[model samples]
Target: MYEKYDVVIIGAGAAGMMSAIECGKRGRKTLLIDHAKKIGEKIRISGGGRCNFTNLNTSPIKYISKNPSFIISALNQYNQEDFIDLVKKYKIKYHEKKLGQLFCDNSAQEIIDMLLNECKLANVVLKIDTKVIEVSYKDKIFITRDNSKTYLSSSLIVATGGLSVPKIGASKFGYDLAKQFNLNVIDTVPALVPLTFNEKILNKCKLLAGVSANAIISLKKTLFEEGMLFTHRGLSGPSILQISSYWKEGESLNINLCPEKNIFNFLLDKRNTSPKQNINSIINSFLAKRLANIICEENQIAGNIGGLSNKNIKKLSDSINNWIVEPIGTEGYKTAEVTLGGVNTDELSSKTMMCKKHPGLFFIGEVVDITGHLGGYNFQWAWSSGFVAGQHA
Candidate 1:
């Protein structure tokens, strides 16, 4: 009635493949299956096809979870250095782009191919385009059935990922499965996504779309300093995306267009040297001409004021330096790079990534509550968590 295996893992993304390969290497008869036609589609399309595989400066501190310390043990067990050594062993040429984010030199396919080759060498069986229709537990075995065959295993690892980039087969199947097993699933939201604005800000963003500037974006006490981009929809680029993970609904973001300069003081100096000169001309020297105009216009300034009072200059300074913009919402999972939450860490083992109460069930990758900052942090989490689960599964 069923084909038996020591381990049956669902999903074939980065985490799934890594877990499968490790399980096989440990002499377990491993089977990895996925509903999608291609395995590692996320890897194939990441980093603009170059695949930002991992971050050299990866630490548990970079990850976000309800239990902030949940990532410690796994990250310690299989760190970024370990994964990098494996990449070195395969001779995959990679380069560090910025902030320790490592990417393939040619294509993301290299990373996928490497994982596939490792899976084959470990004798791990991968079945693509096979959707599991039913899953049930019997005695001490986990029985999972596809349209073609039923698989029985002692261990089941759920690496089904999360609802992000829906066009790539991302879904809530992972969360649903966790709930089916009585595991607590955390509320999820879009992370690392562009923030949309109201009609007035939307028009300004549309007018300044494609314009980018080095900026510091802050929400409450959290902040990110990176390149910010304006889009027709709203705000995007690294700064906005990084802050989006921490930004909540109905919260206004404090954005500093000029991080290094004290604009208020700069204007005071300029007032004496060229009091008659258009203030817009002075602000343009620091910010883009269009952005400067918007700030002046929003503050009810015409920029041609000769001998303007100190009060008027302070308003312009505040508008440029402490610009406040509240996002109506995000672009949603359609454009989100990752999901913010899933299978609560409290219900899972930090060291093994296995369900604490459900003995044989394991959760890893984006399916878990752990989410990392933008860059290669999420990929590192995938490798570390998957590696630890594979060792125990």
Candidate 2:
């Protein structure tokens, strides 16, 4: 026997649930399925459980994609306000964290429940712990597998997400489905992940573990100002994770330890005021004692500020402001919050997320080539893309 529906969505994640709800709202038959025993594993663990669901300041500039304009339509169609309204309607209390990031006041499960409730209202059917073994198209019908059962649908939406946080059930299932239908895929890489340093630099900064400072990291012409944390493995925190998206092997990372001040000029002026102060004392006056000592010892500049030559002092200050260091690599998908690249955006219609060659087949969420910056940008993509596809798919 063959079961059928107007729409069949795979993954049952943030994007899948949203799409399913939309389809059901349209009075179209829809079924949402996921291989995982639980839905929204990533959502449950996101933002340390609060779930960064959207960013108030989200824009096209904050996203990385082959064709940046591809996201404009969907983003403008269903933005942060639309999702915020849903949250409010469901009485899911939330607060805006730093940099326009919106997080739940309780647990991320609230967001998941919101989506599920929306699905329920629309009468969308959900099947969990269901695995899709194959996908094929014939006679304008899409077929999916779940071990022994096969289902057919007129519209098939792939919201399986990307290969990040695999422990939470992330996989390349969407990419594989896109390829099965002959769609092009971009090379995938880890994003919003920590950087690992070489032994040389790791040893030098070993004692600096657990230290966090406000810094600006520059990579490939992109700069981010946020907290940089020194970890036992390497560097992490907001600044490092933001820059890691643009980082490549062997490329140097230019760091400004004191982003708010001009270190060289500040030191030069301070020297004139306290000409009798020692170099260590002068550094400690402006920076933390431990950090100041580490900077001085790393550069091998010695003695009191008054005893140093003008050129040496200038160099020391310059090094503090423009420290250059290169990372060996990233922590990979195990720690990455999202994948940098996936199904090439060129292969699909930006407005509807439907493949140009395969109509009625849509690829949404992180499976697309577009990847957003750290914060709530990723979730916004899931919402916007899923919203658009749900309308037309």
Candidate 3:
């Protein structure tokens, strides 16, 4: 006989685990399954292993979705404070990093353990390393198959996340499952990933590798003021990664290398006070030594600041203030922190995260079209959406 459950949740990641706990808490027999041997691998490695679990400043505005207002209901229903309360209940020591990002004081495993313990207390059944072979719906019941067993449930929740960080088992299974159910799946792309430059640009900036500076990276109207890092492949840092979500192929990024000060004014002041100082030397005080030299050489400003003509000074200032770079592409899903698109939000109810046409089917987490900015925003989405679904699933 097939094992029966009130709800069957696929993927034991953040969303699935949270959903299972809630469902089980409601006195529903819940079964949470994953193909991986270990659960919460992404959470285990997130935030340099400390896990930026949630953002204090979480709002619907921070998310990107086809339906921009679709996330408002879930977010309002389960805000960051609600999750913070849960963390406090677990006695997980956490600290607030910059920009309202909250990270655990210890390893991310604390988060995984907390979720696992919640599931245990809620009496949620968990199955790891169990590959789902097939799924079918009949007589208002969903039937799912693993390699050696068949399971039946009244409700099915698909928390299988997006196709990012494939090494940790990210897959297109969520998108495929959405299609199988005739739900619209948006075209997916890598987000919160590094941008790669062309050979020409890379060659010019290659010497600046490992250099980091306070920068403002802008794509169209959106701007992110944070630290930008120069890498061998291209640029990767809080600012660049934040902007990458809004960037598209064939678009150029406007980078303000020194957002904290006006380069033109600084250089002009330096020209008066330190006439004999090399132009690059003045720039080096603000930027990295290697990047300063590269920018000076690229703009053909070789002499001291006092010897530079007005035109040369303007050119140098422009190079520093409004540097434009066109990236060839991104590092792709191999290293992307999240996938930008997924099951279309239009097909699911924002309040419950359940499919409009299919009563018992739900989609949550990164599998949904709503993608958050870098930091703890994505985790908040997972919690909000998962909680909403679990309440009704």
After superposition, the stretches of candidate 2 with alpha carbons farther than 4 Å from their true spots are none
- 258-372, model 1: which lDDT tens digit per residue? 9999988888887777778887777788889889888877787875546767899888887778899999999999999999989999999898998889889999999999999
lDDT (tens digit, per residue) of candidate 3 on 1-393: 699999999999999999999999999999999998899999999999999999999998898988889989998899999999999999999999999999999989999999999999999999999989788899999999999999999999999998898888787888898999999999999999999988877876567778898899998899999999987787889999999899998999999998888888888888899999988778888888898888888887787889988788888888889999998889999989999989999899988999998999999999999999998999999989989999999
lDDT of 3: 0.91
Per-residue lDDT for 129-220 in model 2, tens only?
88888989999999988887889999999999999888778878888888888889998999899999889778756778877789999976
Q: Ten-residue segment with the worst summed lDDT in candidate 3?
A: 200-209
Q: Which TM-score value belongs to model 3?
A: 0.98
List, in order, the clash count of every candidate structure. Answer: 0, 0, 0
Pull out the clashing pairs in model 1.
Answer: none
Assess each prediction's global lDDT (C-alpha) against the native.
0.91, 0.89, 0.91
- Candidate 2 residue pairs in clash (backbone atoms < 3 Å): none
What overall lDDT, based on C-alpha atoms, would model 2 receive against the true structure? Answer: 0.89
Candidate 2 is scored at a TM of 0.97
Alpha-carbon shift of residue 393 in model 1 (angstroms): 0.8
